[model samples]
Target: SIPTSAGSESDAEQLQEEQHARSVLRETFLRCLLSISNKKVQFRMHEKVKVDATFGASDIDVLNFQVSDLHTPIGVQKEALIRCQDVISFTFDV
Candidate 1:
């Protein structure tokens, strides 16, 4: 059954609240990323692989990360792009 406009005022208020919450969360996340920028970070990946890199920037969608001085088992890469899907976890000092 189609919902009438009778309850739309309440529905609109609820939607506005939800939008505000999402905006706040996104802003916080962006701030966190800013703090990590230009910092050394350790990444834990699948297959028990681990590496270190200087954080650069992440795409808006967070599909990948641009990093510098990536230290891998083979050697150090001057610059690289890491797929977020390949990363299990990452950490850095505040």
Candidate 2:
């Protein structure tokens, strides 16, 4: 039979590996955000609404994105914070 300590040790190792993976993913995402800063982006939101804006910055949690020169259906907004929940996707040119 396998020892209980052996199972616990493996569990701890797995947890550490998972944490490392998460850290890497978060770092990569943050880098992508940085690269997109100051670039023009097109956001596809709910109800098929789309808008163009200059990417500013994203909150640490990525819950919202700060933008500039937001061109909405109505008119242009000088600056805005777009909720991530409202956005289905966004794209920018490299």
Candidate 3:
């Protein structure tokens, strides 16, 4: 279904609210990452590929993951940065 535009003032207010909500969500996610730092976590990627690593940290923009001792099929990597976009999901023991 097609939607019509509201007044500029209303649109601006809505956009501001959306941005604020996104900011809050990002902050929460960062805090969660901090809690998981230095923990062993397994990332699940596409095609059912899974890799285990010692979680180090993440960039502010959540663009990449800093991990150590990454266990892949071919070999174990001493240190690597996993692209966040390639990860479908991940899990760790709390």
Full-model lDDT, candidate 1: 0.96
**Which scores higher on lDDT, 1 or 3?**
1
* The best candidate in terms of TM-score: 2
Report lDDT (Cα) of residue 37, candidate 3.
94
Instruction: Using lDDT, give the best candidate's number.
Output: 1
Candidate 3 residue lDDT tens string, 1-94: 5448655888879989999999999889878999999999999999999999999999887789999999999999999999999999999998
Candidate 1, residue 84: Cα displacement in angstroms equals 0.5
Spell out the clash pairs found in candidate 1. Answer: none
Backbone clashes per model, in order? 0, 0, 0
Question: TM-scores, in order shown?
Answer: 0.88, 0.90, 0.78
Error of 3 at 92 (Å): 1.2
Segments of candidate 3 deviating more than 4 angstroms: 1-7
User: Could you tell me the TM-score of candidate 2?
Assistant: 0.90
Candidate 2 Cα RMSD after full superposition onto the native fold (Å): 4.5
Question: Which lDDT value does model 2 have at 91?
Answer: 94
* lDDT per residue (tens digit) for residues 1-94 in model 2: 6655656777889999999999999999989999999999999999999899999999998899999999988999999999999999999999
